[model samples]
Target: MGAARTSDRRRRRAVPWVVLGLWIAVLALTSPFASKLADVQRDRAVDYLPASADSTQVAKIQDRLPGGETTQMVVVYHRDAGLTEADKATAADQIAEIAGSHRLTGEPVGVPSKDGTTLMYPVASNEPGIDEKARDELVNDVRDVARGGDGLNVEVGGEGALATDAAEVYNSLDGPLLYTTVAVVALLLIIIYRSPFLWLVPLFVAGVANYLSMGVAYGLNQWFGTSVSGQSSGIMTILVFGAGTDYALLLVARYREELRRIERPYEAMVAALKGCGPAVLASSGTVAAGLLCLLAADLNSSRGMGPLGTVGVLCALVAMLTLLPAVLVLLGRRVFWPLIPRYGSTPKARRSLFAAMGSSAGRRPRTVLVGGALLLGALALGTLNLPGAIKQEDSFTSKPDAVAAMETLGRAYPERSTQPITVITPADRAETTLADIRGTQGVDSAEQGRTGGGWAEISVIAKDAPQSAGETTTIEDLRDKLDGSYVGGPSAEQIDLKDTNARDRLIVVPIVLVSVLLILIALLRSVVAPLILVAAVVAVWGAALGIGGLVFGPVFGYEGTDPGLGLLSFVFLVALGVDYGIFLMHRMREESLNGAEPVTAALTALRTTGGVIASAGLVLAATFAVLTNMPMVQLVELGFVIAVGVLLDTFLVRTYLVTSASVALRRKVWWPGALSKEPADPVPPKEPERVTAAAH
Candidate 1:
């Protein structure tokens, strides 16, 4: 007996050091790859295109050409009154300097608008050769040489310039987003735990999980050809912090509860893990299963995000369940400082927000359910008000130089398009294809641009501005006229993206719903409960998007929506929103199995898990809200919609509506499940005991 006890003591002492050493080693191994993630991130339209898109084919062909993918840009010089002789000379001189400094595919051609207020030059170069840094340098170098003053405006625009500007925005987001997320989580944790030292534990663990996720993400990219975009990568970081912290909250809360009963800290932690580990695992499993369903998506960015997000949530779970417990046990109860949860200590008696809400919901369950359903249905109607597909120029919250230049072109060249539509055809048909492209309806002109690898590239300019209806007609007409050729460029890429997103929604949405439903069924072993959660999350998504629709245009001044916003947001909201539902329902199942009556079980589960769920929701929502401050409009919109949905689900739906429905339905909520058949005799209901708020 003495030897066994000594051996146990030694094992306990070694656990923390072992776990700490493992984490340090993980950090060391992941550091190099994690730091290089930014290097592999691709921001170009082609990088995001659907695999079967003509735009993707065009990009592939361009990459195989002699110059290895040309960077096309437009330099616009404008004067409202008219272009003076000096202005024309300055424009020409600037173009000359640019051509001299860089390897141009051909001589830059200056095209004067009919209004005489603008002189635009079409510049193309292959020196960048698919290298993002070189392309950005080329664009920046050309912009530096084309400076304007004295009422003359100059701006560099087009696909290459736009890509550079977007990349800058994405790169800038990496640091600020992480910093802001950390600060927010720390502050919220401090408030919830009220212990200066306790909050740091989860935050540090989450940071470790985030770092590990980044390395794994980079590996996935290198090994499996996963497409990493700014949006996908940013969301992955958010999930790591948000989801990781959520798991920590659940584990810590249960641990605190277990500590009140068990004497030894390590033994208490073991009991806590035994009690709630399955729920945490089920929640993370559902999130991973739902995210993995994104593989069915046609959008490359969305598909890649699925795996990266799964990696984040799973890593966070592992850290919280293993590393966190080890650290906490080593530190003991003193880590809580002024608010340490001592064994044999009873919590103070106070009415909790959820308990109060549950009381009201219990009294009028049907009324509350009906009202909540009506509210969600009404909010969902806002989707009809959402704007159309976003144009590339309008994708930024603040206008960059590329957008400004495009705006100038729109105003000065109102009757024509400045952006080129690239078409690739058989080299033998170059002459005839060029002629046919020029003759196509809405074509302002056509020229043979590049020829290599048995292919000829033709550039076509439409009669109307880029993204306008006239240009759309012209692009379609050209594709129809040149059936064997691939017609693509910035405009066609957008069209393909929009079409592909619609298809992905039809496919991936159902997959996500089914996948999540299956996981819930397996976890809860109840068909009715899973359906309710699914319905609730779907309603939350609709209502959240409706809120976005209501605000995105009239409040935020955005005129367009991202093509895949609906699908991506739905997947996130459904998968993540259901997290709270799982926690609540899992606790309720525990209560039922422990012989509590239906209503008692429901209210007790809510009373026990409410504070943690609320804290988790706040942290998750705040983390997502951080994205709204980003310059990219898509991130802002995505962040806003999801944050709103989570808040709605947390406070209104999860607390009031779900609780009320559970009360009204009683045991039928678990219909056909084993729990429903094994109900104990009914006990008179009483107010649920309140959990300590510090557990949050």
Candidate 2:
């Protein structure tokens, strides 16, 4: 019988190895597709536009036209004081060289400012058409040919150049962002664990999860026609690391506690999983569900982000819960070398930071609650300081050549727009649309550009520079006048984006709230507790944005807020904020179930879980903060707000305010639940044999 039992134990040990082997095979199968994700990412304005928008329609129509999507550029030659004869000759020679080398749509037309300090050649081509690579090459070739000397400055800018520049920035982000995030997470893990071997486990697992997520994201794009953009894909990486590490922290903490009690590593892991698996599952589920709510968004980029983000969270959760546990069980106590959790050994008791915080909150819960509320409210008022919508030229932290050219155009040609407002009309009604476009209030010039496939493309130049208020009005007037014609360009795309995002906020916000609240209610088995969590996260969202308002313009020098910043940040913060809440509340409920008084349960929960929550928050916040170092201003803004919000939620809201509220409310914090009912008779609480350091 003993021999048979030994054989059964040997077979059980092989199970995890088999599971790991399967995971390895799956990753191997998915790796090639993952590498191709960058090739499929589309960042064109039209790609992000709402389907029903005229710009989106225009893009489709244009693609069917002779030129497909036109590649436009402005080659600017500037001599600030005044263009010398030599400079003019140099500019003329470069423009002529460019026109000679490439297929010229029209003779390179020179537009000189009144002061003669700057001269710009308007170059448009359809040779590259809709191929982004071809378009970028054309722009690069043009820049290569256009050279400057004798104090003459030359820059290439326009829609195509802007797109090329943006792509370059995106391409650069994947490597630096991934490395920085891994380093940050590794360093933080080393600090948190204080062990040479332990930190690498979760970090390595997160890296694997990221690799798998990339493969799955690529598959979604190829199989289901899901749109992927740099922004969405970058955020997916962040989620994989941020959320994945958080789950690892909680699991390892619980595993350590169980290691001190259970004889075998596998048994200890099993016990730890049973104790904390539900909370981790629910936390990740809440994040996934909230992200999935983005599918209801009208904007294509926002809508596509839903599936990618969900895949990332779910992938991370699976890797952390399964692979992490398997690896830990296999490695056993040696995984925590130098601080090994020996069987039956206990950690020396000490006054924890959370204990002191909870003790103070317990003393004057109402005052702490009121003070925290007032502080968040005051910070929210900073929203009034936020700047207007960010202009295209202002969307980069460091101005690229294209943006520099546009800025020069803005200054030298303030009276006329450099970019065209594209109008795609049915060939049958082309004449009528042309008449209306010409008659538009701010129109400077209108001309037919390309015609084919029952459609005609007309380029309209506005009196005001691109993205200016007057130019926006002109496009709107053109759209209002021409019934079937589509008005689209960079400026119009912005308008559509802003409108779509606002509409999405209205649609998506409620869905996220309801979905997350329902999930919380189900997990906690109580109404009041879920409501408190929801309300707390909402407040954190506002305070975070308000804090952004205070810093973005006056402090960080950002010109405008991203149109989707508020909505996207809210979704991320609320979902992630509630994550820590779930940990704390779950532990509180556990203690309460074990017969601890309400106040003691809340305080005890804080004392034990506080350090883990803080560490997770730091990891998440640091991972997101990586975005601020990227080149794009929109990304920087989004990263700043989300990173700041996580810190606030982690340190202040989750740690103090929630604790205060719980202390103030007592059993009422869990009203409408069986646990809320006062115990018939008081029972002494059992002494904690192990530190409840895992995320609740």
In order, how many clashes per candidate?
0, 0
lDDT of 2 by residue, 315-340 (tens): 99999999999888788799898999
Runs in model 2 lying further than 4 Å from the true structure: 681-696
TM-score of each: 0.97, 0.97
Best by lDDT: 1
Can you write out model 1's per-residue Cα lDDT over 1-696, one digit (the tens) per residue? 678777887886787789889989988988999998988998888888887899999999999999998999999999999999999999999999999999999999898989899999999999999889999999999999999999999999989999999999998889999999999999999999999799999999899889999999999999999988888889999999999999999999988877777777777788889988998998999999989999988889889889988998998889998899988999898988898777778789799988998888988999999999999999999999999999999999999999999999998889888899999999999999988887778999888878899998888889988998889888888878897899999999998889899999999998899889988988888888999899999999999999999999999999799998999899999999899999999999888877788888889899989999999999999999999999988999999999999999999999988898889989889988877675456544443343332232
The whole-model lDDT of each prediction reads 0.91, 0.90
Model 1 weakest lDDT span, ten residues long? 687-696
